[model samples]
Target: MENYFIESNAYNPWYNLAVEKYLADYVQKEEVILYLWQNQNTVVIGQNQNALRECRVQLLEAEGGYLARRSTGGGAVYQDLGNLCFTFVASEERYDVEEQLKIVMKACQKYGICSHFSGRNDLLTDDNRKFSGSAFSMTSRGKVQHGTLMINVDVNKLQRYLTPTQEKLKAKGIASVSSRVCNLQELNTGLTVDGMRAALRAAFEEQYGRCTELSLDMLNNDKIQEYYKMYSSWDWRYGRSPECETVYSHRFTWGEVEVNLKLHNLIISECKVYSDTLEVQFPNMLEGLLLNQRYDIQNIQIPEFHKADEELAKQLKETIMWFSGVWR
Candidate 1:
């Protein structure tokens, strides 16, 4: 058995993971995987999930520099220095995701952490506080099973960073930032994130095979660049939401902005912004600018208007700037 490890000491969450995904996506089937815990903060969204719906944009942007939308379907998960992430990349012909998860579970059991698989992909403690969540992406070369292991994370920050989920609210009743969360340190008082990562690495190596160090790729490629564009853009993140709906509205200066909109899968299907600002000729200039394109917004082009007059164009630019200022 051959193993490879990508040690990212410091990097943005999305890029670091993307680097791993890109390289792992093409590596040989005999490859096994191990990655050390990194300090960068990140929000990893399920592949089919809308980035915007999974997290609070204002909060995430303020704390975590970038958000990553994965190519697998699951709920959003928060990761930081306090978290230890691991991945198992094996040839699909010889590997099983469930067995890979068991390899991780054995590691947790060593620390007296009674863990069990929850629902489709979560690994929860005996008391039911989730400590690990798993997701998989398959390539012709193989399949990768990746998940996060909580060691001593700031639960408060986790809540503050993630968007509210009705599913979470209904099931756990721990919605929003104010909720119950625990770390291994709180439970055992001896395990650190680094220690946990190292222990897991040893366990995986024993189970999968020998491990080797792999150099990190820093250059931009088409596939990685595309992932960055898709992940960073608001449309791909929020517009693809499955829970939220689109919002539309128009009104005079004093009255309500009577919003009329269509929301599907928590994403804006269509939107129109209107306001009687009277300062610009095209008060509805944002009509074509979607109020909610979410993930698919990256593919849409900003509308073009054929205004020939130089003075009119300048005036329009000023008005547009002013209009944006009001919203800001």
Candidate 2:
């Protein structure tokens, strides 16, 4: 039988350290799972992505937050006390990614909530709202699955922290700030963060077998420490991206304007905005927008321009609508 432990404490370095150890040291025959709680605000990005395009660095730093990169492939996610995190550690030979996902889906069903797998790797409700996001990674010996379940998170703050996907901003016909999302507590008032954690624990243990709770101090083996050091390094966190150029621009009545986004993989190389008009705020405004996205322009959505004259504004709005489907 496999051993599984569920934890209730909020964000700590030890939580991920345990996961790395399970993947590396735990023999293939034994399976280990962890449910981690994080109270501090943080952004966890995917392994195979550019960090600059994933998080709003200024907002995160102003709040004195931690930005972590995970061993998964997806976008960055905002996690806080209201979120419940889960990790499954198993030998690569025994890991069945699809079967593991079904275990999560079953847990949500037990709460009287119906969830369906959406897109490449997300669990959503019938109304097309996503509550849980997951990603996976593989080492030479084993595989690791980690993700988050939203309980009572702050949607306003979440939207404010992550860069908006261009397609979503354009197709919704509303400001990115106005996008809709929900929390588990909102749907089931009787359900708390701890309650959700218990449900997952029960469901996962049923199939993978069960084990007693093991404390971090007990599992501080040498191999585990090595994986933790790797996870916490700068090269593994923000130093894993390749070269790329991003574009950000604001368009108005006078034709259109464009900006060149420069980045050295994961860091901001520089920024340059060009326009034929005499607008003086182009550089500053572009810089402000740049603070939100690290080094990409393809996904950043420039806010609608402001006009002084009512008649001119109306005409510009109509013209903007025409290009909405085009540019967006």
Candidate 3:
């Protein structure tokens, strides 16, 4: 099969993801594609994950980080400039995850970093610290195997942004997220992103015959722009989240506030507010306003109440925002 080596210069997570999907959906020829790219601060969640549960929405908002959902199923991951991402797109007839992983392993081996596949879809160093995690998905014409390579990632930011479940933390036998991850730069200080890209290109050529370089313009056309709009929209990013119910209660200096929300497809299907405060209009004002609206506070429209109930409205907004994990 012919090998096409494509390098993306886009740093936006939505653009990069659109490019990946375009390759997987549009490229139907019998060829092996090796795509290399990177993104800014972004939290990419699996297709089957609950975004609010997988990430700290407040922290991500404050840090100017983006949240995206990929087509593949895997745990949420943090990406930044320090990380390198790769996508292997190939026809189903030539699709083999182990073979794709071998190409990645060969690239890492060139830098004297001995790594091996461990668990289901991870690459770990000799000390068992995970440096890479991959996920797979299939289209009608092709298959995609994509993963992130941690080079010099910020462990503190990763820990603060990603909120893995307690069961997952327990499975790793680690209490903190930082302890389970490692960076290739720590293993070899001389390694750089450019050097890694070069090594990977050489590995691709060695494994499959000579490669032809493809430009981003060839892939970033009108079709990709439509995908970018969908991927970057709030509705597609958050509205497609799985249905869930959450009850939150908090005690303030004034009184106690409790909110129960039943969400379907990330929209507030049912909402009930209970407060011990003497104010009654606050809860009544929010009664029907939140129905059929997104769970996001930014999309919520606040109704005008009596001037006497201004403080109550402010407190009510704060309570809902806090419990819903919404931040400015």
Candidate 4:
């Protein structure tokens, strides 16, 4: 197995995200790439999350922070230069979330911070305060797992910009985002952004042995620039908010989902699904799958979910199927 490591020199969220997408899409079979980067001041949201619902856009922009929509499903997260982000991209056969997490866990232990995975996608301190939030997805070329490692985040700025979903708040039994999260610096005053990066690299090397360091010159410059255009555009960042007559919501062990439907003559005219599920493709595909279908509470035309082979698709498909029998 070949392993490569890249530490992005840029702090721009758009460029960094574009690079991530490209590496995941163009991954070589049995090859693993570990990417590390940061964004100055950004509120990154999940692909299927409602931007307006998850973030205070006007407030964040007015404060000079950017809002970025990532190619993964998860809750909105606030990132600054103090935050370190990592992505593990590999061929489907070589992708292992557990193995990737061990690298991160190993790195944190070096700083005397005993961290562990919480629930499906959160990395928490021994005392249960979350310092990192991760979301994973599948690409045409392979699978990608990327997440934030909060080092010295400004809690005030985070709370100032994000609006957590009530379901999420209720599940964690927390009143606000600030209460549930902590920066690594808060736990260990000696930790710095650069220090954590080095530790992570060391841990990665420990796991994969010698890795080929990737330089910007080796990347596809034109494709990354093209992807940057989408990440930086308003059309891709904030799509029109859905206005539906009915909303069906549920909190499964995997994630929380809110399905909105606008019906016209008993036929579903418009459908929008908002979830924090880790898989990126399924939520974005939900509208097209459910559109133009009958949505009666008694007898609705469910989508052909069996056609999807991904686990998240199967779980959400069952949830949508159950939606047919219930009403909001």
Q: lDDT of each model, Cα atoms only?
A: 0.60, 0.62, 0.81, 0.78
Clashes found in each candidate (C-alpha, N, C closer than 3 A): 18, 3, 0, 0
TM-score of 3: 0.89
lDDT by residue for model 4 (157-188), tens:
88777853332211111122343888898888
Write down the lDDT that model 4 would get. Answer: 0.78
Per-residue lDDT for 1-328 in model 1, tens only? 5677666665566555666666666667566666654535677777676554456644566653466666666677777788887777666665687777887877777777777777757777778787777777888778777788788777776776674433211111112222234577766778887667667776776777777777655435778766656656555554455544433333433332323345564344665554444434343444444455432333334444466544434434443343332211
- lDDT for residue 119 in candidate 2, whole number 0-100: 64
Worst 10 residues of 4 by lDDT: 167-176
Clashing pairs in 3: none
**Please, what's the RMSD in Å of model 3?**
3.9
Judged by lDDT, which candidate is best? Answer: 3
> Which ranges of candidate 2 are over 4 A from the true structure?
6-10, 13-18, 21-27, 30-35, 164-180, 219-230, 246-261, 267-328
Worst 10 residues of 1 by lDDT: 167-176
Tens digit per residue, CA lDDT, model 2, 74-116 = 6677887788787767676667777777877878878888878
* Window of ten residues with lowest summed lDDT in model 2: 168-177
Error of 1 at 30 (Å): 2.7
Best-fitting candidate, measured by TM-score? 3
Query: What RMSD, rounded to one decimal, does every model reach?
Result: 6.4, 10.2, 3.9, 14.8
TM-score of 1: 0.72
Q: What is the lDDT of residue 67 in candidate 3?
A: 89
Q: Show where candidate 3 strays beyond 4 Å.
A: 164-179, 306-328
lDDT of 1: 0.60
